[model samples]
Target: MELAKMTPLAGLVALLALAGPGAAETFTLRIGSGHAVGPVTYVNTSRDFLVPEIEKRVAERTEHKVRLIEAYGGSLAKLDETLEAVEKGILDMGHVCFCFEPSKAMVQNLNYFIPFSPPSAVQQLAITRKVYDQNPALSEHFSTNYNQTLLALSGYDNYNVGTKFEWEKFADLSGHKLGGAGPNLVWLEGSGTTVVQTGIPDYYTNIQTGVIEGNMLFPSSYFGLKLYEVAPNYKIIDMGAMMVNGLLINNDTLAKLPPEVTDIIREVAREYEQVTAEALDRDQAAGIEKLKAAGAVITVLSPEERQAWAERLAGLPGAKAKEFTEAGFDGPAIFRSYLDAAKEAGYSFPVAYAIE
Candidate 1:
């Protein structure tokens, strides 16, 4: 009988026959993400690279052959529900964005609290990983509170400035209108720019129809949205290349795996972080070129001016550190530590914010 046409009982019997007496067990897993496959790098890389790479490594390195049942675009779980969904066993594993779980994973999102990071995804992820290694509670919370293991970390592309008009310095944005969803709003605080509460979907029409003149968003998103047609100027803010997305697996599912398989999965997951970062770096670079080709003017904010903008937001990071410190995590040290790590790695911030 064809494998696809076989009944459940027959398939089990056939599998046993093939294993013949000393075969290891294979596991089937359901993995999904709320965001669709294309727009979100985490979803795209998870679907194309992480899943298949795990299968290949498991097959090559272990006795078990694992299969992942894929679902993207919220087919299995919505955005904010992914972490909880995996916890409840509704999904064996899934990709999660901490932005959706503000209360649940607040400290995990320190990357956002302290902005003006380099646009390089590689550096963003490395700094976050170092912080995680220093602060065990950050990763521990996943298993301690959510009943899941964080297998890998993922980051978005560079968050640059896209505007309908050209501007040279931070002061140039004064009296202009811009749009952002949340958290990122503070980055524009000191500048007298009016911020419209809008999302990526509305950025195009909002700019075209005069609702807002610019948006603080990722380059790939800006290009993908065709905002260059309207917001034809790009500012290299390199605001926050955050490693805010993670791949998670339920502890129960992980506990069922043989040690060998578990090791392979974890190793592959770490590698997934690096490969996805490389992909984001490429997308960000390529997207800029595409934007220029499509008639967008690009400008790099001078380090001096960038530092001035960072100074405006210097007081904020400490406030966020307290929130985490009060939650019993080492927020202060980590915040300062991240800045130090960034500096040691030779990526200068516009301004070095202190964690009081």
Candidate 2:
């Protein structure tokens, strides 16, 4: 009886040895965003595109699997705190909006400071990707200073003004307090308009309470936030599409991932950028239609007036370049490269910014 029991135990041990390396390891990734899930929003892209693609690709191409733990709508980190949270490893990944931390992300905010480039969402996305891929300094800044790796970049459609009053000419904005985020606020520097320095979340309350006469934002945000109910006038300024935010992974978490899994994440991130740009294009058109249906008056400034606005802000880009150069970045080279890319992409600016 003892010999028979010993033989079965030896057979069981042999069988266990043949089972290859146990099951594949499952790595859990926590992706956090301040934005909530809504139709035609970046959060939708994260939920419907980035997460699923990463999961599918990892399963198909690697022995490891990824389990995405999503924490959106400020459940993990608010918009402004996302970069810090990821750096501190509180979240594995996050969407960091450069607009929120302009001073720290000066290089990434290049698009915001240089207006009258490409207003097409696709072109803007392509230009930013191209610039970032070619410039090692920009990438180094993220990894060295922030303890994060940038996977992809995304942006909104061209900015427009939504106001309680109509805007026909530059002079029409005189004495009006308009709310805008940093850097873009400088676009109104000499237009006789007062900058409220507010963000999108506060636009509705500010406009409704007469604290601000209007807010500068894209059509998708204006429509999604239902700002037309209070600020019912829309002016299409076409102030160039901006690279607003990026998908970033904590460096420590990225270092822990398998090589194959890391490759898939990078591949899917490029696709995510394309999908986001396409979504912005679609949503802006839909948003415009919705705003019109909701009794929002829509108007486009004439070419002459648009050029005048561009000239008014022409000093901004060079000033920004000087500021960056003083801070040890090759700002003029980056600025020139961007303009060259925009030109190659078929964009003709109304006013040429003197970067040199």
Candidate 3:
């Protein structure tokens, strides 16, 4: 096999062989999201970190190359339907928001039920990942039910309340109206406030039109969306960061690829969790300052009132766990594990929210 005598295809094969164990292939993958990049940190990370890092890592370490086609703002699918889109290969992969897929992705909704988690995005992600790793069912729910593989899980920054007016205690807020995403609306339970179901993208218009007077949201999303213009009262309820979004790939598409490429994709996806969380944390910290500069009034719910609120909401975790059990999951165990992880990480919740 003299160098000058080698045929072109054979030479290329030799080069690939020298580079790695598997033959090289160029893969075209389509990644998408329901929301635009600026308002959603997960969507931003999909484009900013996941896409580029996978391409870079594969090229540097393996013979495979990846070509990612990105779509956002409901181009491929809405946030709730991205799971179905990925499952059916309408989009090769997409970011799935669990808040919208409540029934289908039950286990992934654990964070919302177990509220008042530590407000740190980095710590929240760590807790979620730990629970996911320890409980295989969390990840398996995707592959078993959706025909999609979970690549990585992501979290929103510290969730808070933004309103047109301020109230000191949950009782004083009774009879007002507030809006939030599907699962989180229950977080305001028993408050005289009427909880309305609203998504982040619609919060601005909904408030402006008087459809709702306030909403629950993370600071970064609140700032990115400019909802501060309408709802200038920032209430730091610190409902905790929630692992609500997931990066997923169609199983059929993954099966067509060689291990070299799939391995790189999975590795990069794991790193995506840390990168997205850290960036969201920074954005949240900065968002608060920006909101204030723009004339948003900020308030912190007193520790006593926060504890009272948590106590009022204490039944939620246990109730949801029982509901999960009826749906054929170990609800008690799952809830307990998440609580243990948070406690182990040294988060002293406002109250001892039990599984009942």
Candidate 4:
């Protein structure tokens, strides 16, 4: 009899009978994320790319099977609590945005402090993955300090200035309240732009109420949030693609998994990085066109002014490096390695950061 003709129950019985003396062990992994599913978003990528690939690879390569329980869209934990949730074993795995917990995950926020490295999301992902692979200190900080294993690093397109008013020159931002989150607020310093610590959700209302004149955000977010309705001017400053978020597994949960399963998880996670990078690139292109159709004014800063903005924020990276060192991390070394990896990948910065 052909196995293909068997009923579902019959097929399961036959498979178990084929195993002879033992039944294949099954494990359940509960994965959580704060964000909801949306096209080209990280949450969507996790469902479409990471989870299915992991399940397929594990079943193919091992005697074990995994059942994934997804708890996304803040069902399990808020965005800020994701890292801690994974650390405390509330969830077996989760997506954590380092920008959300900058102090706790200071070392992981390195890319946010340094701007103007590269404009391409793929290049930025390569640079960050290289640093994480080569720099033991960075990976260790996640595993040892946070009790989580870094599965993959992913990022979005370079940020631009979304404004209610026209931004033809850098000087136009002087005395204007620019909305930014976490370390990016440092980018506006010394440029005479007063920083308003705000997040994506509040940007629209804030701009309409004149609470903030503009925000430093990427095209994907700008279009997704429909910020063009309020902030009609979009300045493509190419402030460098940022490695803002990561997927992590609880160290305790990882330790309990079979070695083959762990290996597959890590392998699939790397592919997740590539998948997300490509998605960001695609979304950015589409977003720009959408913004144009919506009648948003889009412009790119002149190369000279872009370089000048970089020069003005030159001191931020080195100062952040010092803070890293004082916090018991090799901040300067990681900073140098990040730049080196970027340079080796053919990325040239507008201003050379003073790491020494």
**Every model's TM-score:** 0.85, 0.92, 0.92, 0.89
What is the lDDT for 259 in model 2? Answer: 83
Error (Å) of candidate 1 at residue 12 is: 16
- Distance from true position, residue 338, model 3, in Å? 0.8
| Candidate 3 lDDT tens digits, 1-356 | 66668899999998878888465678899999888889888888888888999889888987779999998988889877788999899999898888888789876888999879878889989888898888888888889988999989996899998988877888877888899888998887777789888787788999999999988899999989898899889999899988888899999999998887889899999999999999989988998898988889988999998888888888888999999888878888888888899889998887787785
Per-residue lDDT of model 4, residues 253-315, tens digit only:
898888888899999998999998888877888888999999999999999898888888888
Off by over 4 Å in 2: 1-23
Alpha-carbon RMSD, each predicted model? 6.3, 3.0, 3.7, 6.0
**Tens-place lDDT digits, model 1, residues 138-257:** 888999998999988896888888998889889889999999755577789878999886765467889999999998888877787889989888999778788888899999999988
Which stretches of model 3 miss by more than 4 angstroms? Answer: 1-23
Segments of candidate 1 deviating more than 4 angstroms: 1-23, 169-177, 193-213, 302-304
What's the CA RMSD of model 3 in angstroms?
3.7
Error of 1 at 296 (Å): 2.2
**For each candidate, what is the lDDT?**
0.84, 0.85, 0.87, 0.84
What lDDT does candidate 2 reach at residue 253? 99
Tens digits of per-residue lDDT for model 2, 1-356:
35545588898888878765644789999998876676326778899999999999899988789999999878989878898999999899998878878777877888988877677788898888778877778768889888999898886777889899876898989999999877788788777888888776678899999999998888988998889999999998898778778899999999988788899999999899999888888888888899999889999989999988888888888898898898788988888888788888888888888997
